[model samples]
Target: MSSLLDLHPMTRRSLLGGLAATGALVVLHPFAARAASNQAHLRLMETTDIHVNLMPYDYYADKPNDTLGLSRTASLIDGIRAEATNSMLIDNGDLLQGSPMGDYMAYKKGMKAGDLHPVMKAMNVLGYDCGTLGNHEFNYGLDFMFNTLAAAKHPIVCANLTKGQLASDPKNDELFFKPFVIIEKKIKDGAGHESPVKVGFIGFVPPQIMVWDAKNLEGKAQTRDIVEAARAWVPVMKEQGADIVIALSHSGIDAKGPSEKMENASLYLAGVEGIDAIFTGHQHLVFPGPKTWDGMQGVDAVKGTLMGKPAVMAGFWGSHMGLIDLLLEKDGKSWKIVDFTSEARPIYHRDEAKKIIADTKDKPEVVAAVQEEHEATLAYVRTPVGKTSAPLYSYFALVADDPSVQIVSNAQLWYIKDMLKETQYKDYPVLSAAAPFKAGGRGGADYYTDVPAGDIAIKNVSDLYLYPNTVQAVLITGAQVKNWLEMSAGMFNQIKPGSKDADLLNLDFPSYNYDVIDGVTYEIDLSEPAKYDKDGKEANPQANRIKNLSFNGKPIDPQQKFVVVTNNYRAGGGGKFPEIAGDKVIFVGPDTNRDVIVRYIISQGTINPSADGNWRFAALPGTTAVFQTGPKGRPFASKVIGAKIEDAGDGTEGFAKYRLIL
Candidate 1:
């Protein structure tokens, strides 16, 4: 084939003679040649961790959100696709469960065997070629996962998951889409010869599914590490005729390595021989786009040469799409990528003239559909569940035992008791626990889910419970339980107790989600440093801010055993909590904590959702109060005992102020 196309060293006269024979080619000259020179370029666009931003949907506002909709992304995708020589659209996962649409689509409306779930429905319309699964995919269990996947027109490829009863069965029919797929395309060579290129994509998720969603996976199947499975299969794909291999990882890129391979797998995965590029997500933080993974400063972990190979992890929740462009040199039997550029498709960009409109726009249909669902959800979410006799608050979460967290624990235990009726783990005494995922900083003063005398809408419930974390139970010793609280004490920045009011904590330490425990009583002595991490390493054992830990009105015994129930995020190593390790896990929940709360509310017919009031700070009597407030919450918060807004700023997020008045 080469012999037929090769041009031997020839005389100028011979070249002229050949060119004259093709008069049109001679006339076109460099104009035609320049276009050919740019032909091999392939622009790859990736959308990762788009947990239901189908329309310009916003769960917080409980309304038709116009800012964050995927429809806004459509215009960008269209413009990029129009300018590219060849391109492939891939979503990186967690498409099914974040907003009200997901909840409405899941347990409420319930998808039919062939019906497209709203997210899947919107994705199908967008025409995705490939995608992977974020851990959230299993939140609703396998049957529901498959039903949602079955609605997809694309391949749902992940190399690490086991389907049904077999780990290796081809018949497992695992995903709503294929686990990996290859796209064949043609590009013009330098001399106008048509060259065929095969771009292969392999998707992966963190293997911690065993801990994150154990109840859903325990009897159904298993999951393997992303790197190990990807390494084994990339070579197989090359053998099957792939030219360039890209990993669409639903994992994230992190600073601290080792344990969180899923978070920073790309760094090490870059060394994997057959891979050329990687697209990643799952941590919800964007990369190479104004973010840091731990101590590493300016690390474009999302865009880096991991082991000499290119990789990028897009930010989560449709915030950014990862883009990587590679130039390949045809090296006989294979194509070796010679140069590449990795970047995030930022939602907004300034033009050469320094103007900024939306760098993208919403897909009209996607916007319309998700908007319709968003409104319906709002109407449904607002209907009150019950009346609250008093306001619930989170200001004292980590510093003391919190009733806000206590409510979650009660709901989980309640849900577990009923779910266990027919399950094998029924005999165990279950205790539920949950940390606030969204307390204040992001949501402002109103962000704290304290409801005042009225019907509590589901939208309000979301603030009470953000994130769709399933109920997980870990079998822990009494000692480990105490250690968990010690780690939580990290939320407090130790100020020498009498040091004239040293700011001992990040006031913005999110209250609802970070609040510690409910089942036991303990005190955080303002004098100690946090025992654990910003990284999940061995926590300092001597660190002790918590004092007089007791359960059931007595000092707890370390030998006592109990199933510590919590969410998938915490159980799967989210906040570096102790005792929730994989070995100690007895059950991974398929039911979400929010769902449990909702169900518990329904069961009681009237929810007395009050804090157990198990813990409290000694007293802030001497310390001068300090906190800011937004226009919406300043008055109410200032009136509350020992609380006062000392300063304030308009919250860029819209309603609450970045208050600091103490």
Candidate 2:
């Protein structure tokens, strides 16, 4: 039902007389001059999951492009705002620490009072009204976040953050962002009088910040759950006499449990009353359109309302700006939206001559500021990181004791073994677990780091180790450790022994959480159903997807204790890996996982690494397979080099296929 309801004011009558009378004059009728005067249509704009892409601005590239900069988005914002009567721009978190700009600020550039963080600088030029906190904000700790946020002209709203034992306290909040803001504005009426509307906005972040950013916020502060916190605060928002309520969620949309499990947080939150519209991020996705997950009803394509309300999660980086237009019907003292449409505004559109021009005029000031930082960071992004003789690749991660994980584990164990020399668990066998982060998903082909044949530079290093996560080792029994792999095996759907083109895998599963234990050997039996416990417990250990679990040709003894090295998040149950939780954590290493890998590379001085028979795709004989995978993966056939891959041509950027190996 998308329609062209309104036309340019001048074009209303076709003004046939103008076309007939003024030959060249009517050719350049600006789109802005078309709308009515009482155009109080609120344009709710969003920048979701912008993981520090300041350049294009890609922190990964360390250069500037016309595509992603808030500068580019600013062009679209101007056009949309000019067409609307009123508007509000918001960022949905994960904004602070993903790119090299953030890395430069943290390690090289360093932050100080009044120092303009590039992303914040761009936001300042756009004049964003408010934003919510994404998990990445705490990566560098509270001081940097506090100082940078203080520099922004907008309000940062997050409700679940705790200050003291009570929900309200001076010490418990983010210390800068307000929990919510009630914005009031006037709209012109047909009588030439002003009418008032009150817009209530509140923000929430995923409660798991405690696990993911423990390096930043463990004993320093506490955060409550997103839903529980909203329940406690949204009522207060209503009591304040606010009209429309919106949630700026750093969390993603949710569907029913079982298949989705922890995935459907938004749907659960939507079930919460009074939440009029939800602007979601974190798991960056496009919603309410043609996209839908497997085996869900309304989700095959969500309607404008969930639990009777509008919700949207725009695509990530500066790719698109989510624009939701709601038509409100005035009812007595309150106004309820009668209908609505949500879409992302492209940064460019076809002009009269069919040339893709700026969606609107690019804002010169914002572009200049962002471009300046973009260039400075570009110079700093790709410098020499360290040398490695070993090659690190994820080709065999699912099957064997990999050298990449071995290097990381060795580094973690080496770093911690001495520090815990006096501890009782120091006598146990130590192993390290690490997952591949950048593997050609949304990052494109070059995203895969093959620092081949020579010195590894800083640019390639960023590709290999994207995040600045610290190392951590947890204590677990040999049995519990075995169960942990069973959970990871869930990443693969059950590929039948002789099935064709069935993905039997969940490629969308993030590799950061996909920990592979380099100290053990096991095989995934594509023929069997996976046994799993939803509550993070070993409720059903007999699930048979993983077979032949052993070490040195002997079954792993359940009573044997092992010191498992991993990133801090997994040691704290980030992926709900069975038997691994914060309480079982033994040693927290000083160096980050990225630092450990980098340091390991530097230590080796010339690391020769490869898949080297660590793991393999269980041999399938004479079967043709087909299943859907992602878009970026399409161009690189090595992603499915050994299989009969279909072009699919969808550019989904995920990997799932039915296969028959002769």
Candidate 3:
């Protein structure tokens, strides 16, 4: 383990001043009076949702990106450590599986007993004190996850993950990893006297992992509810002499009160006793910032607290580092927190011209740790698979039908139709549902998928299907299908009649949740409010946004049955879509959606991926709307099939605004 002084030379000066102020030298002189205070400052830093972004590069775009990478965040670690007397760096999970580098490691390189995963190698260089498990860590299966974690130099803990069946009592369950770890450190108080402080770290992963990665975890593992596990184990930590406890919640902050297996339970977990602070993630959002979680009940965004407990959530892909500064005073036999501050510090920021500017350079040691694997991942993603006749992009996916989503829907329909040919469902009408994974929201303007008319590579296919979910076919009636589409219509905000330049998209809704079902033509009525809210709950039972629904130029009958091809996540209820669940699933394919897409592209030597104008927004005279997209989407504005797009101007956060004529 590297000492704070060794990592940053300036920390020595800062430590001396901090120790003198704390009264650490009182023992050296018996006659000297004790210093004024016995308080010590401890800084806790975190990196969450790294997703194997060790280098400052985007594998899908095959270019350098200044906004991401742990190497860039590592550059700030030394400077941050220098500002504190005692500091501990930890990770808040989602470190494994997101980029092409993770795929190259899991599917190609393969981990062995002693082989260090590229992410672990890079993280080990920074000396993470501890880390928790994120839902993405289980994407590659348990064998690979455990093997990769075996090489981590620091302790990794998760209280909710269990092996086999869950026991009635959360404490009696067979835990897969240590529930918590108490790190003992020597600290100097105001009198320059060395004293011991026991800092406890407990971690919780979202229980939704069982549904998201059902193929990998069913029958082999189970998960307890996050708050239940925290409530059960936090007291044990205190009983074991843990003076201060920090919860590494790999969950998002939701204002909704506690429920069974809630995906976002950080707000509820913060209310648990004995937890001094919290490090939150799994939403890929930043706290103490104005983007998300602002104005939500129980969330103090300005103070970075949940239920009055200090908390921090770093943005995804190493975009920001979550920081928590604590002022601790020794209270007889135990230490208690007196005051605290929290922040999510970014590695880069946008300039006045909306150009990304990096705040720090990449750390040489962290980059060197994963250089070999980084090069191999580049080679792996660059391998050509097939060619496309037209360009594929998702810049206008939210406002119109898109080729990027069209290609995926076409591939899924092609594969599922052939798959059901020999089965009993062969005669059933087949439809495919697909969504744009990247639509330039919280991921930033450069995050949109843009592939030119040329050869398609593995990277492009991976960009189209961002998850490792397998293909699934669900059986449903026409009425249920309409309800499904109704749920997806929540992506847009309701526009009033005759309203000019109204905001089109519902920014709160995630792009991945906006499913576009193919093989059926329909129009989204913007004049009506969405029947469902973002959580799939019925917000307006009387609302109807879907209109002119037809299967083959005829109105779909309510009793008619159809098989919808989708990914395992949706079929298994990963997203809270109505009438879609495991019971409706008729077939679960063995291959991943990404693999199916690759195969589909290869089989069709050359393909033309163009939107067929199947779905469009209902025309409303005297009503116009506007939305923002990547600046690079200007040239392809005419390609959008449904609406008339006009240049509005430059938008905030490097996005270009466009007006939609309805």
Best candidate, lDDT-wise? 3
lDDT of each: 0.61, 0.60, 0.84
Tens digit per residue, CA lDDT, model 3, 1-662: 11101110122322332233333421221111222257777789999988888899878667898878999878777766665667899999988787779878987788877888989899889999999999889978999999999989999999999998888888899999999999997776656677889999999998877766777998999999999999999999999999899999999888857789888899999999989999998766788776456567889998999999999988877887788888778899778888788877777665566567666678899989899999998998897768999999999998888999999998999988877876689899999999999889999999988889989897788578766567889999999999999998999999998999999999998889899999999999999999999888999999989999998999989899999999877887766899899789887664467767876887897888999988999999999999999999999998789779999999999999999999
Model 2: per-residue Cα lDDT over 1-662, one tens digit each: 01111111222212321232223223211211332333235568888866666445444433334445555556556555654555688888877776667776776777788888877888888888889888778878888887778788888888876643444532244533577888775654323345677788888777666655666776776676677666766777888877788888887655544222132366666666777888876654555444334445334234544555677776565656776666554567666665565655444433466443433234577767777666767776566545565555533333344444445556665666654555677678776677766544455544554444456654655556665455667888888877787776665666656565565445555555556666666666656555664335554456765566666678888888888888766876777777688789766543445555554555566655543343344566654344343333334334432233445344244443322342
- So what's the TM-score on candidate 1? 0.66
Error of model 3, residue 513, in angstroms: 14
What count of clashes does model 1 give? Answer: 38
How far residue 305's Cα lies from its native spot in candidate 2, in Å, is 2.7
Those runs of model 3 whose alpha carbons end farther than 4 Å from true positions after fitting are 1-36, 385-404, 410-455, 461-517, 522-548, 552-662
Model 3's alpha-carbon lDDT is: 0.84
Candidate 1 per-residue lDDT over residues 1-662, each given as its tens digit: 01100111222322332233333223222222243343355667888767666765455446543335566665456555544455678888888876656766775677667776678767877788887887878877878888888877777788877754434533343543455788776755455566778889998877766655677887776676667777678888888899999888877654445443354465666567888888777665555544244345324454454555666666655655566766655777556666666666555433456443343456576766556666666666667655555555554343334445666777887766655555566775566667764455555555555566546655666666766455667777788787777666666566554454354445534443353565777766655666776444455657777788888789878888767787766776665566566567556554456666765665565556555656544443445323333345444544343223343455445543332221
